[model samples]
Target: MDIRQLSYFVAVYEQGSVSAAARLCCVAQPSLSAALRQLEQELGVTLFARLPKGVTPTEDGEKLYGHAGRLLSQLQSLKASFSQPVARVKFRLGLIRALGVERMSQLLREFSNNVQGLELHLVEPDEHCDARIITPQLLKAGEAFQPFWHDSYLLAMPPGTPLSLQAEVHLADFEQLPLIKRTPCDAWNTLYPELVRRGIKADVRADIQTIEYALGLVSAGVGCALVPNFDTLLQRQDIVLRPIVQLKLERQLGLAYRKNQTSASLTVLRQLCQPVP
Candidate 1:
């Protein structure tokens, strides 16, 4: 019904338990529970299903989560508009979808530790942010780009599969295998056509939008996909990752910000992201 109640609801939905959400909000458990009950009563819908271990969102809760996230974000921006002038620096950072949520969280934790008096906001690609962690493909004119790192693509196969035994898989190996396709790989866009022109075949059995989805299909024995050697994906025990020595492909990752604008937080981030000599 109110901002506080909605905050409590969002925390509960995200954290999955009243106790956990209470710890996150720095509020009492009973008070947080009372707020959820009040919200449910007002909405006349059960938002979450109470379970022995924790809670799971109901269908209605899932629907409410999207709206609540936007509402809270806007509210924070509105408050920041007035308070930000005199308060500690509030910085917004945009991350591309290729960097999964877990990776983003890890980066945020590191940034929080390194910077003082910084209130960091994680944003999507479309939103206006102080700076963004993005691929070179998304860079625009007048935006200053700083190369951060490179992520190489690797062949991802289901565990114990015949191809998993190979120390290094060649591009020719893909000719005989059913490949799972993940969209928006700049490297693949160029490589696929060139492969076809050179008499190599990529038998794409499935097309997926995200690396996670492609990895899931690979784990299910659906087919193999070319996935980025991201930390979380590389650590997955369900799939086997092998280097593609025949065709080396990688995309450069970077931080981009407007050239003329200067901010304390942005300066700090630039200093931190400076490449080692």
Candidate 2:
């Protein structure tokens, strides 16, 4: 119900006894037990099983333990930041899963370091964030969108594969090869429809969820995969990336943020992420 109650709940859950938790928290045992009882009453859930010697968390208590721990950690961080002379600005950033977090880690870390009093929080694509790095499909109506990067889809194959040596690969060239499928991809969703429109059949070998898994399959020479022209993916010497000659598909990435939102950090992020003309 409150910070104190949550703290007490966590203590008893960890210590497994009211007396032990009270000693650890420097509080009276009766007060600690009363706090836990009050918390359970407020939440309308039996949080623990009373034992003769100690206590054990019930199902609901186990679930709340994780949440309470994280909340306490965030509260501690908030208090510590407030104690400092410089005010800390919490900045949320939303990233599309397909854009690849590993590729952006270094650049983001550099940005975080360069900007003083800035605390970056990574969140889901649709959540509230100061700025969002998202694809065109995810771009909302009123948010300010700035083109950040232009990425093309490339055919990735093992280095020694027959198609790897081709200067250009076509739909017809794919008939004999087994294609590794990546689901929930904007590129695939767009490409497949066009392929169907053109009456080209894709000989799908497997349907995978993540790019890493798809790349793993390609690396093991299980089958060829279609992936973005990311530097991280392209830099692999074990795989060959060839331009799709017949289908010149590419995605335009942009930063989307509310028009009313403006800050020093956002300005610096815009400068860093905006494409150079």
Candidate 3:
């Protein structure tokens, strides 16, 4: 019925007797017993079977014990979020492979330095999911998430692969080479249709996991790859990246948390990942 009742119920279940629960709760035995009795009355179910040796939880009591434990844990977390200092706020950030580890790491370091109470957890979903880490459904649901950047995809090739010197690479030319395709997703649906229009079939040479792995294969002359234009990879001498003309490939990057909750720590993180004008 209430947090206190749940706490008392859990304590009795753990200690196996009201007297023991009272000692653990720092309350009188009679008070603990009364709380348990009141809880059972409110719920209209017998909770524990009384015995001389100890009280054992009945079927209903066992079920309530599990639910009450979870409820109390969540309550404790909620209490901590408000009562604890700002530096204790926990964050979970999801990223695609193309965001570039070096760039993301730098952003995280800067954020940590600026925000005292911040704890950030970063996840790369490319290893598991076929879709881009950030989906339209996730955004449209008005989920407590915000997009920071949507990077246009680039073509990575071995040095001197002779891609056109144009500002953007056309899908027609992509058909001419052995393409190392990233996994198929709705994000690239437009580009795939354009490829079909041009009468060019993608010669998918490999289906690699992450952009880095695909780039490694590209650098080794396995096949060309489409990747994010993270400046760190551009510095590598063995690989050359050109803007993919006409393909217009891009991936969105963002942060998510529970809605309507303002977090100073999250704001600091967003500033770190802000794109330069």
Candidate 4:
């Protein structure tokens, strides 16, 4: 009946679960559920058939999905027309910030050329996205993930630092190591417990957010930081990268979406993301 309800319906239909849709929409699960219930009451039809794992579209739900998708697309196009003469198909994608600058830049360039009229929005922490290119660790329940290109985390420090002579670093090497804390990183958090268990306390120097800043701090000799191996970093003479023998944190980057749900633009992206030989 209303735009909000229609949007909620579309999210639930695509996500196949109210909880998953709530996360994608950055809303509380209860609020999203209440909206769907109210919409179902107003329309006099059940939109979804609930299951133990997740929800599936009912016959009525499938019918509404078509109309709602088109309607939302039109509204988005209308909004875009004011900014640019040509209205583009919007595709909101969630990208993890930990993925370094080189990879992100390359992906954007490659994707734009492949998908025409692609209005890509990199929504993170707050995932208001049709599809997400995040690691498996961050994926929602029941979402099918197709792994693409990715890399591992490494100990990044300025040249001639204390442990630079060692070809392979270990948890024991971290004692007295000054570290930049990149907060709210799931991968970093996973490595934290192991460091604690090994009695390797990070000589906390900088508490930063973005990976770019973390790298910048590393370059400045402020402190060493754990950064993804890929980056314009490989080429940078200022920084040296060494693998942690004990904890090799490799990121499984991929296309995460509901299989068969086929978000219009993301369906094409899914095909493009197939692991190549």
Which of the numbered candidates is closest to the native, going by highest TM-score?
A: 2
Error of 2 at 3 (Å): 41
Error of 1 at 75 (Å): 22
lDDT of 3 by residue, 181-248 (tens): 77643334656677878798877888866776887899888888877766445555677777865556
lDDT of 2 at 267: 88
Provide the RMSD of all predictions against the true structure, rounded to 1 decimal.
Answer: 8.5, 15.7, 20.5, 19.5
| Model 3, runs deviating above 4 Å | 1-88, 124-137, 162-168, 184-188, 273-275
Question: What C-alpha lDDT, on a 0 to 100 scale, does residue 37 get in candidate 1?
Answer: 96
Q: Which candidate achieves the best lDDT against the true structure?
A: 2
CA shift of 207, model 2, Å:
2.2
Ten contiguous residues minimizing lDDT sum, candidate 1:
101-110
Evaluation by lDDT, superior candidate among 1 and 3: 1
Estimate, for each residue in 1-277, the C-alpha lDDT of model 2 and write its tens digit. 8999998888787666678779867899999889989998988999988766677778999999999999998997898677856778889999876776443754585577678777789998888888899877787877888987888898888888888778878877776477898986777887778778878787798999888899899888888888888754544556888888767678888888888888899888888786846
- By descending lDDT, how would the candidates be arranged? 2, 1, 4, 3
Local error of candidate 1 at 163, Å? 1.6
lDDT of 1 by residue, 41-78 (tens): 99999999877657878889999999998999899879
Clashing pairs in 2: none
- The global Cα lDDT (0 to 1) of model 4 is 0.78
Which segments of candidate 1 are over 4 A away from where they belong?
A: 1-89, 100-103, 113-119
TM-score of 2: 0.65
Which portions of model 2 show Cα errors greater than 4 Å? 1-85, 101-103
